[model samples]
Target chain A: MLTVEKVSKEIDGKKIVNHVSFQIKQGECVGIIGPNGAGKSTIVSLISGLEKPTGGEISLSNRPISSWGVKKLAQQMAVLTQDGLNPYPISVFDAVLMGRYPHLSFFQREGKKDYDKVEEVLETVGLTDLKDQMLDTLSGGERQRVAIAKAMVQEPSLLILDEPTTFLDIGYQLNILSIVKDWQRKDDLTILMVLHDLNLAAQFCDRLILMDEGEIVKIGSSEEILQEDLLSKVYHTKPEIVRHPKWDIPQILLHYE
Target chain B: MSKKLFQRDRMLWLWIPIFLIILLIVMSVSVSLGAASVDWKTVWKIVFSKIPYVGDWVTADWSDSAETIIWDIRFPRVVLGAIVGAALALAGAIYQGVLRNPLADPYILGVSSGASFGAALVIVFGWQLFGVGRFTLPAVAFIFGFTTLMIVYLLARVQNKVRLETIILAGVVVQAFIGACLSLILALSNEQLQTIIFWMMGSLSLTDWSYTAVVFPIVIVGAILSLFFIKDINMLGLGEEVAHHSGVSVQRTRFLLLILASVITGAAVSVSGAIGFVGLVVPHIIRLLFGSNYRMILPLSIIGGAIFLVGADAVARTILAPRELPLGIITAFLGAPFFGYLLRRAKREYF
Candidate 1:
């Protein structure tokens, strides 16, 4: 479980994340949805300890996040930011192996245990065949899967992905979301992800947090938070919520200007 | 059935020949062929005499003058060239990794200009302010070089993160300012002007066994230290956020790398007087061959860089015969065209 209490972040006297508070329970897949510049990424950064909050505390598993060393924090939580794309031509295996960095010591090589774990993660992410392939050769979808594999290799309690499917195609997006959902169910992993697609978030996420201009407007189950009126109010656009015939999930339809 | 094993086996085989051929060609031709036209036999004699037990068989027919020329003069210069080359390349690789910019060189921190100014000050005043025994000029150069780099690094660092553009701009500005200072010293100095001028132009002529003795340990230590940080450097190449998430102290690692690289650049410049392009070119060539893996690239750069500068030095010595060209000039001449070709190739490939 992760709890963020009254977290606020300011840069040069301008508030980026303002008085944001949220709690994520164990095994819950929470989605943060907002338009561009809505401070969704900022919240992820704060949660991942990339940026410190000006006012408030974040705790994981009832312990203060600040008490955790970087490696300890990494062991508990793995974050894959939108800019996780590496320009270097590294092999996929090596790229995923980087996730084990926090677990390994400076002088230690990747031992049998490390390689075994990596092999397991490669299989989990469906990238076992592409392990030896160069990252540059992989497609955008394959790259995101590789990123997810990297995070999974950490075996963290919480997985935080900021805009993981922003550049991916619909099939790839579904593939990633399904994979996350499957992992959440099987491993009981806590996931907090940012998504631009309201429909995808509504379908895949157990809970949804709606944010607008650095503040969370609402947080609840997708059915409660994905109301047409609330989304219209938050996004300043008309959105229709329809029931999914099979899954009983809310489906969102946005009306363009 | 064993296709996967075959692929892995082939990959290993591919690198072995490529690495060995380049290593061999660069080492043999660079060391054996030189300006003095000394036969391979004499060169062997001179080299073997330095070995404790094997001296007699090789040096039986060698004269004292020949031995002195080979052992004291040419040998030290070659060794210094190799050390400086390795240092420069190592520094270049680190800077590129830290900045995530392929074009970044060791001079990005303004160490070269700082060392040059230090040398200028020593040459003009003929005084060693640092009080370093024996090798005062180089010691002074190193001190100023390291100082200038620290200053530049500090100026470039804003809110802890060192912005690539800021570092590059600071380096250029500080370099210009130091160049003016050097000019001022040149204008004021009356005595030892010729020596000052020659040194400023950059030379390997001043190299001796004593200079080599002083720099060898520092370069070796710096190179070895860099090798240990290859993994950290690899992480850094991915950018600060990724590195941090991977549990690397990004800022501290970057700072240490910069200082170590500066020490290398300073030490090399102190002895070789700002020999350019070896740092810029050698690492690029190594990367082209070895891929971007720092684990392989760093060690290969050390050996490859040594071979490169030794070859360049040999060419510099032999090409002009009796009239020796400055080693800096030779490197620049070779480096500029190679740099242009690389730039064109990179543009075509990446842009």
Candidate 2:
């Protein structure tokens, strides 16, 4: 559904993303896994149109990303950035309703349809009770939930989530991923998310893209990408790979080396 | 969200009319309390007589001076006060949204300092725009006010991109430099020192229809133009990447909003001589009463600020009777304590 060809980004003579390329089919949830400074987030940003790649092209379906208008691109894709939203006095419901922004015209107010979608998403994200509360008053976990609810309400064809589980607890991390995975299954949605926890990525993603030093080192299923030698080579540490006892999914284990 | 009358549609219905009514009441009571001591009856008749479909329904026992006070002196002062207040408050709200900083105000940039410098030049050297007229000081002040913002914007831009921190840094630098220049000018020049000093402190005294004529179009048109950018402004409050992902041309929107809002603030300061807390406090108060949505906050701040400043200017005119205070003093005295009260009541750290 999405193709990123030989994309490259440079900042002040430093290569942030260098000639990276990947493609994900429809109904796929792909995880970008890497250590710090691997350009995983930068690649996702390039795909999301938040930043333009200095070299190479990205396309959705068949058209170049540059040809797509912002509102059109927004309608097709939703992004959950790692940065915290500003601490304004916007309420939870209002914050979630901002997802409808790209859909509505400049002067058009959010209607019953928009509100209904927001309500449904709020329920899905388990934030219905706190919809009226001020956003700044929310705990970090609650704020992450709100951000996820916002992305869900956009109802986009593709979702790009950067560090979605950063502020979440283990329970909510599992819960949010399950909810997202279920939504992807139901809608045939394409997801490209950045995750630090390789175990969660192995469990949730259909395929993994491993990055190192602004380059793609490997891209395959968990069985192919989670090898101990490959992981150690990329992570610069020794690691062990084991399967989930019940799910037959490969998970990472750190070594003392 | 929660079932409250304060959200979306109900907010438009509930608070706007209430503020409009309060604005009317305050304006009515305000014009009557000036040094001339016009009664409420005279004030009411003079105000109502000007409205359509009610021109001749009243007794005609009022004198010419009373009419002059209502029409020539007090009416213009009141309207000009509203314009300046609305401009400042809307500018404040816009700056806060664009910069995504709750503590920002119209004067947070260099508008006030630039205006003071221009007015100081006219005061210190005794020169006027085109060698003398009622509009000389304000005209020079307006030009200087606008030019300073341009310089600040230019200084803040790097690689044709403007960062929020750069803008704030540039604003602080320009403000300090201009403020120092103003102080030096004040110290060096002896004649007309009181005039320069009082203008520096800020006031609404000596305003007339001429001042109103200059400000009316700029403020009204600027505010209406701001409405079209409401979506962009709202998106901007989210982080830049979020706004970009949402399809906002973040840089273009930021630049347009900054220019429009600064223009509004410059116009207000040129005429009113830097009324301090109206811009800062009105938007804050509106966010507290309503929400932070600029669609509501902008309009409400317009009226809310109009009411606050009219009443404050009235108090400035009458609080000490024969000895009137500057409008800035009244606002700070009243706004500071009220802001403190709001802070004590607020459960969040909005600032």
Candidate 3:
């Protein structure tokens, strides 16, 4: 569904993403994992077309990124970013309804169809009780769920998650991923998630793309990419890779020097 | 249970329309109280006569001077007040949403202080460019106000990209510089100083149909442009990425809306001096009752602002009788306290 060919992005004399290329197949769950400043978010931003690549090309379904005006591109993909939601006080329903904005024309308000979709989404996300409550009143976990529900309501082919579980507790981290995992299965949703926790990435993603210094270090199934030597070398940290006893997925364990 | 409450909420929506009608009634009452002391019935007769089908039903018994007084003199000022009020409030609401800051006002772009300088120059020097005479001050005021906005906008831009915080900060800096210059100008000029000082305080006292005629089209056109982007503006509070992901052209919407909002504020300040408090308070006040939805906030604030300012102008005219209080004083005094009360009561509901 998406392709990046030697895509590079530079800003103010610094190469944030350099000579990186990857293809994401339809219905595949992919994770981009890297240490801080490994250009994880920037790469996500580039793929989302929120930021333009300084060189090379990114194409969605065979069309170049530049050709997709923001409105058209938005209908094709939804993004959940780590950046704080604006602190403007708004109700949960109103926040979720905003996801339907791209679908509505200029000056056209959300109609019965839009509200019906929002009601179903709120129920799916377990926020029906809090629908009328202000978003500012929501807990971190609830806010993240609301954000996810917002993305879900977009009904896009591609869903991008940037640090989807950052600032969340372990319990919430598991919960958010489970929701994503379920939706990916249900909708055949193509997810490109940026995860900081290597273990979570290994557990949830079908494949992992390990990155370092604005370049891709490895791209393969989690079992292949989460190898101890490659992760330790790329992350500059000693690490141990273990398999889940039942699930048999690769999980990374960091060690103190 | 919540669905029941939602239905009740639908019932409560009638309150805004009813309140708007009350505002119209108050405006009618206000025209009667100012200077001439005409009765409400007489005022309505003149008002009704101007309407197409209603003219024959209107008694047409009112005097010619009374007709001129109500229709020509007082009616225009009230309508201008409503226009200025609506313009300022909508500008405030848009600024607050785009900047994602509740405290942001239309004057955050330095329009007020810039207009002050222009009005000050006219009052102090007694110079009327192009022999425009009295219109010179407002024309210069609009030009200077617009220029300040452009300067702030430019300073906030880096490589042709503008950040919301940068522009707001730039406006603060420009306001301070222009404010100092204005004070210096006021201090140096001794005669006709009250004219400048009082105008700085802002008044609708100078309003006439010509002022209203010139400003109405500009404000209405600006308002129409703003309305076209209502959906985009509603998404702005989600922040740039989320708004963009929702299909809003963030930077473009912000740029166009900023210009549109500036048009409302600059044109308003040009005609009405620099009324404050109404823009900042009216939107917040409306949001308390209506929730933070821009759909509700936009129209409610426009009407609510018109009501508030015209109400304030009414009190400004009749509170002391014969001599008028500056419109800003009444707005700040009345609006700020009312807003404080609403804020205290609805702290959790503020959107």
Candidate 4:
């Protein structure tokens, strides 16, 4: 459903994302995993159309991403960055309802259907009770959930989460990832996420695109990519690979000394 | 849809009519007040007598002097105060939303200093347009205000990208430079100093129907235009990236909003010299009472500002009797403390 053909981005004479190419089939959950400064977030930014690639083209549905109107692209894709939304003095319901902005005309007010969709998304994110509360009053986890609810209400076919669980606690991290996983399963949604936690990336993502130093090192399933030698070389850390106790997935365990 | 989603509509019903009624009462009482002190009954009768077809129905029971005072002088001055107040408040709200900063006011983009510099220059030279003597000052001030905004816009842009912080800094730099020039002029021109200084302090006393005529339509049209962008303003408050992610054209919306706000501000400042605090504080008062949704804040600000300024101008006119206080003094004196109290008592973040 999405294609990135040798996309590269440069900033101030530095190649931030150097000729990275990848594609995700429809209904696929792809995670871009890397250590710090791996250009993972840069790749997400390019694909979400937040930033333009200097060298190559990125397209969605066979059309160049630049050719799509901002609103039309938004109707098809939603992007959520880490702590992107601020604590404005707006209610959760009102904040989520803003997601329907692209669907409406300039003078049109949010109608009954738009309001209903916001309400439904709020329920899905388990924020129905906190709908009336102001965003500043909510905790970080709650606010992040509200952001996801907002994205869900946009009704986008492709959702981009850039370190969505970066600021959450362990329980909240699982809570957020599970919500996205359930959403992907139910809606046949295509997800492109940048994940910092390797174990969670292995658990949630169907395919991992391992990036190192502005280049894609490998792209394969967790069993193929999450090997001790490959990760040690790319991350510059001693690592051990093991299987999850509950689920039969490749997991990483770091070794000190 | 949940009943909570309809709360904004219901609150609009409750608050708009209430504020409109308050505005009418303020307008009537302000018209009846001042040195001559016509009664409210005479004020209405004179007002009715001035209306075209309605004038024939009403008998002229009041004296010609009362009619002139009520219709010609006090009525237009009060209306002008309302227009200037609404314009400043609406512009202030727009600036705050666009910049995503609660402290932003209408004059944040050097519009006030630019217009003031233009006014001071005119006062110093005693320059007048040949056919339209009175229009020259306002026209020059309005043009200067718009030009200053353009300069600020251009200075803020770096390689075609305009940052919000850069825009504010640019505005301050321009204002400071122009302010130095103003002080130099004030220091040198002895006789015109008082006129320039008083104009800076702001007053509604010099305005007539003609001044009101020029400002009223611009402010009204600007306020109506502003409504179309309220949703975009709300989205922008979240942050530029979030706004872009939600399909708002961030740069274009900000540019249009800033221009719309500055235009209204220029028109108001041309008529009434930079009246302070009404623009800076009225939106906060509305947000304090109501929520931060621009849909409610924008409309409420237009009326709320009108009420606050008309009431303040009335006080400025009457408090010290024949010797009137500057309207800016009253707005600042009253608005600052009230805003401080609201800020301290606010349970949530106002911004």
Every model's DockQ: 0.51, 0.57, 0.61, 0.69
Ordered by DockQ, highest first, the candidates read: 4, 3, 2, 1
Q: For residues B183-281, what per-residue lDDT tens digits would candidate 1 score against the true structure?
A: 888788788677777776567776788888888899999988887787788777666787777778777888888899899888888888887788888
Residues A1-257 of candidate 2: C-alpha lDDT, one tens digit per residue: 89999999999999999999999888889999999999998898888877789999999987898899888898889888765566656778888888888888877877899999999999877899998887777777778777778877778999998988877789878877887888898788999999999999999899999999899999999999999999888888988788889998888787674
Write one digit per residue (lDDT tens) for candidate 4, span A66-171: 9998889999999989995888878888899999999988888889999999988888889999988878778999999999999999999999999999999999
Ranked candidates (lDDT, high to low): 4, 2, 3, 1
**lDDT of the structure predicted as candidate 1:** 0.79
Q: For residue A43, what is the lDDT in candidate 2?
A: 91
* Fraction of native Cα-Cα interface contacts (under 8 Å, chains A and B) also present in model 2: 0.62
iRMSD of all candidate structures: 3.1, 1.9, 2.8, 1.3
For each prediction in turn, the share of the native Cα contacts (below 8 Å between chains A and B) that it retains comes to 0.44, 0.62, 0.82, 0.72
lDDT of each: 0.79, 0.85, 0.85, 0.90
Query: In model 1 chain B, where is the ten-residue run with the lowest total lDDT?
Result: B1-10
lDDT of 3 by residue, A129-167 (tens): 998777777788888888888888888999999997898
lDDT of 3 by residue, B1-351 (tens): 111122113433676687689779878987887666789889988988999998988777878999999999899999999999999999999998888777899999998899889989988888788977678888999989988989998899987689988999999999999999998998898887898888988898866788998899998888777767767877887778888877888888888888888878999998888899989999988777666667677777888889988899999998888778999999999997888887777645455
Tens-digit lDDT string for candidate 2 (B1-351): 221237564567677899899988888788777767788788888877887879688776799899898878888888898889899999999999998777799988898899889989987777756754868888888889888899999999998899999999999999999999998998888877888888977888898888899899999999898887877787787678888887677888898899999899988998889899999999988777677777788889999999989989989988798898999999999999998787677765653
Lowest summed lDDT across 10 adjacent residues in model 3 chain B is found at B1-10
TM-score of 2: 0.94
Per-residue lDDT tens digits for candidate 4, residues B61-102, read 888898888888899999999999999999999999998877
In angstroms, the error of model 4 at B58 is: 3.0
For each candidate in turn, the TM-score is 0.92, 0.94, 0.93, 0.97
